[model samples]
Target chain A: MEMKSFLIIGMGSFGHHLCRSLAENECEIMVVDKDSEAVEDVLPLGVSGRVGDCTNIDVLRSFSIDLFDACFVCMGTNFKNSLQIASFLKELGAKKVYAKADEDIQAKFLKRNGADVVIYPEKNVAEQIAIAASSDNIFDCIPFVEDYYIAEIRPMERWLGRTVVDVNFRARYNLNIVAVKQGENVIPIPGPNYVFNEDEHIMVLGHINDIRRVAY
Target chain B: MEMKSFLIIGMGSFGHHLCRSLAENECEIMVVDKDSEAVEDVLPLGVSGRVGDCTNIDVLRSFSIDLFDACFVCMGTNFKNSLQIASFLKELGAKKVYAKADEDIQAKFLKRNGADVVIYPEKNVAEQIAIAASSDNIFDCIPFVEDYYIAEIRPMERWLGRTVVDVNFRARYNLNIVAVKQGENVIPIPGPNYVFNEDEHIMVLGHINDIRRVAY
Candidate 1:
């Protein structure tokens, strides 16, 4: 695979993390921050680093934004700075722009201004935790598509000893047991003969209504 | 389902969102914060609201902590306050406690202090976005269990017009097409004969390596 170049602005917690993750994936990165310490922190990641206030168009212009495959505006709390940088990146001909927003309202404004994608971390995580908390058996839930969800849940008593084929999972529960979580090990796409164990958590995919019917 | 009551402390963005989500799910909730305006913001959701510094044991004691099914500490930035409140909740015999943290280090400290679950919102979202951004075809990816993941991707050219059974998806690809996304509609658990289309995004469940092989 070819290496992708990324230009990252802001070195707050979110920016620091995004830089580290992209670097681990072996992407070529250039990090920028107003504070010298912030820019210095990610320099060891072996990418280019710059110290400048991104809110200033002159500082942004020095970077030659069009060279990077994508530009990330990762100011965690400064909505105004993030918005301004996102717009500047677009105006400078960055191929793609990703911005971080704290909530839905901020996401809309960021998209309208310049961001191709707005990542709302807090709101998404809050909703995920709430779904897990509100349920009796589900440990975690990820929304799939529309009303469908992928959920991690404890097996019901009746399913403890039965194999996937024996129980006819899809016909009986309207859910697919995509994987089985046994302690720290995850067995993906378990065979039809895979037996259900009491101590294990089953990762299933189905409509929300079907999941509720079985999880409850 | 029987109504479950929850106690939420710290009305930061995460807390505000958690409170609103739980209320929408019809769970009884009591929201607390040091700022009256923060508490008042969630009151319209018909939840009990209070303004008090949770770091004080006296203020926490007044809430009858044991009566709550679960307690959530939603302080966004103050690790000290969140650590203290989490320990206090456990000492007061709160059944379950959930706390939010920015990264792995804080998550560890929060869990050690008495949080039953630590929600690391920013880190989780950052990793997720990195996965999507790093790939060429994958639009989004969710870590399911161990090395398995649920990914949304544009169907391969070879897959268009071929039915699941015709391609022998499970045997040939070692992946499961759990759902098909066509525009806004998601057809979950599509039948074995479901045909792949060019304009549609397929949601597949597979090991990281298998997903990478197909996605790239």
Candidate 2:
């Protein structure tokens, strides 16, 4: 496996988290921020840090922005700073730039400024939570594609004690049981003989219309 | 579908997003915050809003907290206020309570203080971006179950022009192609005879180890 390298600009809550996650992935990372304290906070992650404002072309250039595999501009709530840094990184020839945005307007501007992708952390989480909150049977749900959702849901009362083959789940409900959660463990791609239990939660893939019909 | 009712306290970024999402879900929502400007910001969503300090039990009681199907405490960085509101909501007999936290310690305290669920929006999004950044083939991914991810990935060069049955995807890769992304549309649960094209992205469900092996 090849070790990827990354340059992350900013050290706000989102930036700090991105740094930690990249470190866990064992990627070679260089973090930058104007605040000396912010730079110091991520030192324990075993990554290099520079206490300098990335909005300055010279400061951004000094890091050889083009050399990193990808660059991330993570300024929380500061659309101006994020845009400036993202544009500078692209101007300096950074390969792939990811920028954080709070909403659609910021996301559009960031993309226009040369961001390869815009991450909407709060919006995504909120949507996921909203789906879970709207339904009593769904424990958690993440948007899969279009109207489809990958939902962790309680088994229907009729499904209890019935084997997967016996229920013909895919044909009858138009849903795929991807995994079964029993206590602390998740059994992925269970065999056809696997029986639905009252205490277990099943992770299934299906359209929202179908899921709602069966879930209730 | 039954209309769900929500009481969201604290009009921060997450709170606003949640309110917007719940409104889209057609749920009855009531928003609250100490800042009148924050309260005014969400009035356009067709939901009721109140500017009051929820940490004060008297102000919280005025809302008839027990009437809502669920309550959300969404104070950004104000752990004290969130804990106070969460505890007060549970005491007021709110059916369910969800609270937002930035880290594990805050999450633990919120859970202990009567929050039925704790959300880590920043952490979840950061981890998701980290995975995408670390891999060259994965466009986006979300954690599905233990060590498993539902990833939108570029199809391998060799798989182009092959039918789903021709490749025997599930048996060969131990990965399930849940959906096919063709342009802006996603075809969910594609038929066995569906052909793989170079321009399309496939959303697959599999373990990290299996994904890593095949994605490259």
Candidate 3:
């Protein structure tokens, strides 16, 4: 398979994690940051590090920025530099550019300045922590729609030997079974012929109220 | 906080993981399985274990089933036993019961037998593995509608300084920025005014075509 190239423009904790994760997956990574220490820290992770201000078009071009399939603008505090970098990356012909914003204003600016996607770390982290604290049975929760979510719930005693068609889940509980997890295996969009067994995880989609009623 | 009690009626690998995870979060766990070895294996995790047939009404009632906030029926095979257990749990006045199904037929049977929810483990696990194998940028992906999905995308350089209103993203890419993740935090339904920054993960909703186009 052809490898995807990624340029990460920050060497903070989050950036380091992303680089390591991507590298583990065998993706080629290029990292840019003004901090020499940060650049050096991630070098052993197989990332090509360039010590330069991300806002400077010359510095970015020096790294052959156009060759990267995607670029991440991860400078959290310096809004101006981050915005300048995003605009330049777009102008330089990068296929996609994602930036991180500290607040709503900064995110809006990034989007207006040509950023393809914007991220807010504070809010995201809080939600994850909250969910983790709220329920022990939830392995993972992903929002599916407005006021609706999909969650991977550890199977409880009452669900064994059940099938999707028999539960009348959609009608009775207003939740939909999207998939099931058994050990390391998964069954997606299972047909009516599927069966329930012990030690399984159910992937369900529905409003929070409906999901809460059934999942617990 | 008041500790919640959960009864997990299987001692398989999935059950073991669930018990450990729940115990780590400080919930009281009770495990029931016909397999003596399975029960013994998870005993060190501090879960209460019983080596008896979970399908037997006498066995279920012996545990004072009403005290449990929820019960998980996790037997994979032996559909008859699974169905009997679900029914018995409900009849004994358990508030909620979840079951695991090895196939669609079993899942249907469990539901009809009074299981509140049924899980298909093979289905959920496969989808998670597939997505994990396919993309490093996306930490997780959940389908919302037939063609639309929500994904947590790792921030890339081109998105810094952007806001929802500034990009007209829904119009431009047919994608919605639903939430943002930064570090270990999550922001649900972030307003349009939210800003993008570095080192943040983004929760986005859009058609698969659009999600693929923007997430990368």
> What lDDT score belongs to each candidate, Candidate 1 first?
0.86, 0.88, 0.70
The best-first sequence of candidates by lDDT reads 2, 1, 3
| Worst window of 10 by summed lDDT in candidate 1 chain A | A140-149
Q: List the candidate 3 regions with Cα displacement exceeding 4 Å.
A: A135-139, A144-148, A154-163, A181-201, B1-216
Tens digits of per-residue lDDT for model 3 on B81-142?
88988999999998888787755577788899979877554434323323433475777776
Best by TM-score: 1
Recovered native contacts in candidate 3, as a fraction? 0.04
Model 1 reproduces what portion of true contacts? Answer: 0.53
Clash number by candidate, in order = 0, 0, 103
Return the top candidate by lDDT.
Answer: 2
Tell me the spans in candidate 1 whose CA falls farther than 4 Å from its real position. Answer: A155-174, A187-200, B158-173, B190-196
Q: Give the DockQ (2 decimals) of all models.
A: 0.57, 0.57, 0.04
Better model by DockQ: candidate 1 vs candidate 3: 1
The TM-score of candidate 1 is 0.91
In TM-score terms, candidate 2 sits at 0.88
* TM of each candidate vs. truth: 0.91, 0.88, 0.48
Candidate 2 displacement at residue B84 in angstroms: 2.4
**CAPRI category for model 3:** incorrect
